[model samples]
Target chain A: MWRDAALVAGKDLRVEGRAKVAVNQVAPYALVVLLLFGFAFDQDRPLLVQAAPGLFWMAVLFSGLLAVQRSFSIESADGAIDALRLSRLEPAGIFIGKVVAVAAQLVVLEALLAFGVVVLFQSRLGGAGLLVASTLVSTAGVAAAGVAYGALCVGLRARETLLPLLLSPVLAPVVLAATEAWRAALGLSRGDGWRWLGILACFAAIYLAGGAIGFGALIEET
Target chain B: MSSSSSLTRALGISALAAVAVNAWWGLSLSPPDKVQGQLVRILYVHPAVATMCYAGFGLCALGSICWLWPRTRSPRWDRLAVAGAEVGAVFCAATLITGSIWGKAAWGVWWTWDARLTLTAILFALSLGYLALRRAVDNPHSRALMSSAVALLMALTVVLDHYATAWFATLHQHTTLFKPSPSIHGWQLVTMCWSFVALGLVFAWMVVHRYRLEALEERYESEGYLVAIEARRAEGQPVSAAARPETGRVLVGSAASAERAEALVEDK
Candidate 1:
């Protein structure tokens, strides 16, 4: 399963590497969001620094939406989905592969967005260890959930519009947990970021298990 | 013509009678509350409807579980899940509106992010999403399977959301949890119990009707497909049997499907 997942993830990354959509389009979109946040706050450095954690995660989430949609949209074109089904790969492998691919894209996007926050919002990034751990775990959780829901709505007429409505509310916990963790990591307060990281781990576990088990039925319907 | 129809009819009549009686006692005979005065009257609709909404969602999750289990899988279970979700959506809406009404009287606001209220709102949104998902999928089996899966997820999320919100609210200390009943005695308690019975009966009745509506919709969609097929033949258009649309409802449109659908209705 891990081998197949790696193959699938490698294939996705190679395709993405060729197109560079995440770098050219999504990362810049995240920067644009940061700029907009700065404008919305009227360039008040203190307020922007204080709200940086939430604004950063919010940008990642919105950008993550585009990444997940693009990840599945690649499958829908040129009978790629049918090809994947006929490739004899396990549904679990396919699920894990998609999660890995989306998470990889999101991690890079987060790195860029982190830079944007530090430079644009003048926020201090103090806890490097906690920041990295929270980023990886929360990205996995978001990716697992995003791909699961992305698959759920794939091939439907309303896939584009319906994804947000269905995915966002379900992802409320992830946003809350990640934002709070980032808050603690940014030295905003003395609150424990580990607890929020633990919550993110739980979210990742639930969604990853659900995707692996439920992917067969979801793909079969397509 | 089954015995259950008579039972349903009896239940329906009794539920109506109970509602009428409860309304009279709850609004007229019951003394005003010491704190909120007559504003507590919204309590009758709020708690009963909210309780029924919870029961409806609980039924939906149970039906989904039954449908998903290979040993217990049946179209009947899928139908029950749909029926419960639709009814639950209605009651959930009522819960929000009545709760909002009560909140306005007590807190001078139309809405607040109290823990229970927030959870209720999320449940409402999840149910809407579930129903929307059902409508998006054209195939009957796929719709049933996918919606059941989503319903199960919603059920789990509701549990998680409940606890999360409770803890989050305690941490913030900005809002008090909305609990309607502190201490009730005498007629208020009796009337509240009667309201529960009446609303419970109403919920059962709505589920029965909604289940039949779903079955009828399946049959209708299948018949429409058959009509299109016949029209294509009449127009001398090439109609390949292998190329037929995979509606999965053709069987349900035929006599066996009708019998099975009726059986489910009667069995309920």
Candidate 2:
């Protein structure tokens, strides 16, 4: 099962590795998103610093959403996804693989987006100690959510729209807490950023478990 | 037919009655919140809508379990479940919109990223997306089952949104009417309870009516599909416009190509 999962994950990463498509899509968006934020806040350094958590988190969250919507787009062409499904590999494996790939895409996006935030908004470069970890944690939650909800929406008519819809609401607590934690890390208060991080981790775990347990039932439909 | 028809009528009348009572008590009987004043009136609608949304999601999930596992399946009950969700979406939207209106009146702002309100917005939006997806697919079976599954997922919103208010603490006020927050007496309690019951009845009525409409539409669509399938089958193609036929020419032709090398292992 683990090997099967690795193969699926490897297949996705290999495609992105060769093509640079998701990276290509994610990088520019992350950059412009920061630019847009700068435009929105009108370069108010004080407000930007104080509101950094919300702004950064929202930027990362939206970029992840865009990536997620298109995450399965590659896999869905003609009989490719179905063939992958029919390979006698476990559905859970396929879900894990896709989620991991999505998470990798999100991580790269976060790095580039973070760089843009620091350069454009001049967000405190000193406080990125937990930034990568936080990004990965939140991305895990988002990707697991994307996988679970993505499957449910996959056979639907408007999957592109539905994936984000079903996931983001459930995504609130993590995004909120992560944003809060990121805020605290950015000199907001000494309140437990770790608590929010823990919560985000829990959210990610629940979503991952949901995908694994639920994927089997989903395949029955397929 | 008599039993169901009268039930529908009773439901209809009761729903109307509920609406009338709530409006009366809201507009006239119950006094406004001491601090909130006339703006307090938004309570009657907001809480009612929230409850219906929860109920819609709860019932949809319960119905989904039934729909998923055939042993528990009752088409009538499943349809009723879907109806609950559809009706619930309306109420959820009402909750968000009225809450926004109330927030503006009470807080000097129309909307905020406050946990509860944000979550309510998400729930509303997700259900809207689910509904849109349903329309796009136009497959009756997929719509019924998947929509209910999507609705079931909305239960998570109540948890995520309410978590902060319940645990971490927040500015969103918890309602005292339904929850065990202290106690109130006299006309306030009576009016509030009366409004809740009234609205609850209205919600039930709406759900049943919605279910009936779904059944009607499902019937019409199935008949239409059957007619189409009959035409197609008569036209000599084991017709399937979303119905997967096991072995048909289009698939067979595709299979019959040089890919026939693999055919001995698989039957088409």
Best candidate according to DockQ: 1
User: What clash pairs does model 1 have?
Assistant: none
Tens digits of per-residue lDDT for model 2, B38-67: 876776677777888888877777777777
Candidate 1 lDDT, B1-268, residue by residue in tens: 1324776788788778888988998899888878778986776677788778877888899889999899999888888899999899999999889878877777888887665676677788889988888888898878888788789877885575446545664321221213565366677777777788878889988888778777777777898888666544433433233533332233323434334444665677
Model 2 interface DockQ: 0.44
Residue A92, model 2, lDDT: 85
Please identify model 1 stretches exceeding 4 Å from their true place.
Answer: A43-45, B1-13, B161-182, B237-268
Candidate 2: regions farther than 4 A off: A127-129, A219-222, B1-4, B31-36, B138-141, B160-164, B179-182, B231-268
lDDT of 2: 0.72
Q: In angstroms, give how far residue B19 of model 2 lies from its true place.
A: 2.6
Grade the docking of candidate 2.
Answer: acceptable
- Per-candidate DockQ values are 0.57, 0.44
